[model samples]
Target: MTKKIENHPIEDVFGDEICEGDTYFVFGNETVLQSNLKQYLIEKQQVQCYEAI
Candidate 1:
């Protein structure tokens, strides 16, 4: 017999803050990509890193 596995909702664990904005660079492989993208966005948008708030 197979047993059912229970999974918790992400919001339940992370809370409502998870839904507020975009979150990048959570993965190791995506580090370089995130850095490059962040730089590009900063340049193209001419915005400061703190401006993301």
Candidate 2:
């Protein structure tokens, strides 16, 4: 005999992005924002280090 697996609700699986910061973290993984890049450079003062990471 074979057993079947159940799936969780979509909301439970995906969670939620209830604020701007939450949304940013969710989508930011796939794309680099220009302002974030600039701020990183200004804070680090080294482009090579950022690129290496």
User: lDDT tens digits, residues 30-50, model 1?
Assistant: 222232456645755476777
Against the hidden reference, what TM-scores do the models get? Answer: 0.25, 0.20
User: Model 1 TM-score?
Assistant: 0.25
Q: lDDT values of the candidates?
A: 0.37, 0.33
lDDT of 2 by residue, 1-53 (tens): 32232431222112332333221111333322333545444554465543553
Give residue 51's lDDT in candidate 2 (0 to 100): 57
Clashes of 1: 0
- In model 1, the clashing pairs are none
Question: After aligning candidate 1 to the native by TM-score, how far in Å is the CA of 47 from where it should be?
Answer: 1.9
The numbered model that scores best in TM-score is: 1
* Root-mean-square deviation of every model: 12.7, 13.4
